[model samples]
Target: MPISSDHRQYWQTNLRYLAILLTVWFLVSFGCGILFVDALNHYRIGGAKLGFWFAQQGSIYVFVLLIFIYVYLMNRLDTKHGVNE
Candidate 1:
């Protein structure tokens, strides 16, 4: 069976969301944690180096937050696409 235009658009939007979220995750986990570590290290968070924090804990926190954001976004997307339960 052929896919409808709505289905194609819905999947496209979903992929866009995934791409954006994953990019943010990568920037936080790898960019800040490694690439920009020296620059981020100049700052401090609760007495811990910002870069170190990102490398150790910040990425995990951001990932969890992103999960929640994704859930919320997908819920809205599902409703918009009439796919929600």
Candidate 2:
């Protein structure tokens, strides 16, 4: 059977959110940690290197934050599609 338009749209929305969040995570983890590490290293925070901090600790915090953001966003999406639990 063919998928309903609403169902298709819902999946699309989910994918869109996933793509956005993943992009942000990637930018934060890889971009900041590696690409801009040298630039960031010019500045110091609490005597620690900014880029190293991002590579080791900041990315982890951002990941955990993204998890909650994903949960919240998916809940809203579910409600919008009348599929909320």
Candidate 3:
């Protein structure tokens, strides 16, 4: 069966959200943790180097936060698409 425009748009929006969230995760985990580690090291967080913190803990925290954000976003999207339980 053919897909309806609304369904296609819904999936597109979902993919866009996933792309954006994953990009953010990548930047935080790789950018701050590796690429900018030296620069970030200039700052301190909780007595630890900012970059080190990101590499060791910050990425995990951000990932968890992103999961929550994704859940909230998906809930809204589901409601908007009339697919919510």
Candidate 4:
């Protein structure tokens, strides 16, 4: 099935957002959690290990947050572009 121009634009916008968000996600999760973890471990947060928390739990929470952010932004974009469904 062929998509209309409106749908194509909508999909393009969504893809752009997805790409940018995923890139940031990977940077935070892999870069901060694993690559820079040793440096981060030197700092402690509220008696908890910062690096360890980020590696084990923080990344997942951030990813979930990103999901919500994406949904909200997409909804706004859809409305702005008259693509709401």
Q: Per-residue alpha-carbon lDDT of model 4 for 1-85, expressed as tens digits?
A: 9889888888898999999999989978998799989998999877767887888888898899999999999999889878689
Q: Which model, 2 or 3, shows the larger lDDT?
A: 3
Model 3 over residues 1-85: C-alpha lDDT tens digits? 9999999999999999999999999999999999999999999999999999999999999999999999999999999999999
Residue-level lDDT tens digits of model 1 in 1-85 = 9999999999999999999999999999999999999999999998999999999999999999999999999999999999999
Residue-pair clash count for candidate 1 = 0
Error of 1 at 71 (Å): 0.4
List residue ranges in candidate 4 displaced over 4 A.
1-5
Instruction: Note the Cα lDDT for every prediction shown.
Output: 0.98, 0.95, 0.99, 0.88
- Candidate 1 displacement at residue 12 in angstroms: 0.2
lDDT score of residue 82 within candidate 1: 98
Using all chains and alpha carbons, the TM-scores for the candidates as numbered come to 0.98, 0.95, 0.99, 0.82
Shift of residue 16 alpha carbon in model 2, Å:
0.4
True-vs-predicted CA distance for residue 64, candidate 3, Å: 0.2
Q: Rank the candidates by TM-score, best first.
A: 3, 1, 2, 4
Q: Please estimate how well model 4 matches the true structure, expressed as its whole-model Cα lDDT.
A: 0.88
Candidate 3 yields a Cα-based lDDT of 0.99
Q: Which pairs in model 2 have colliding backbones?
A: none
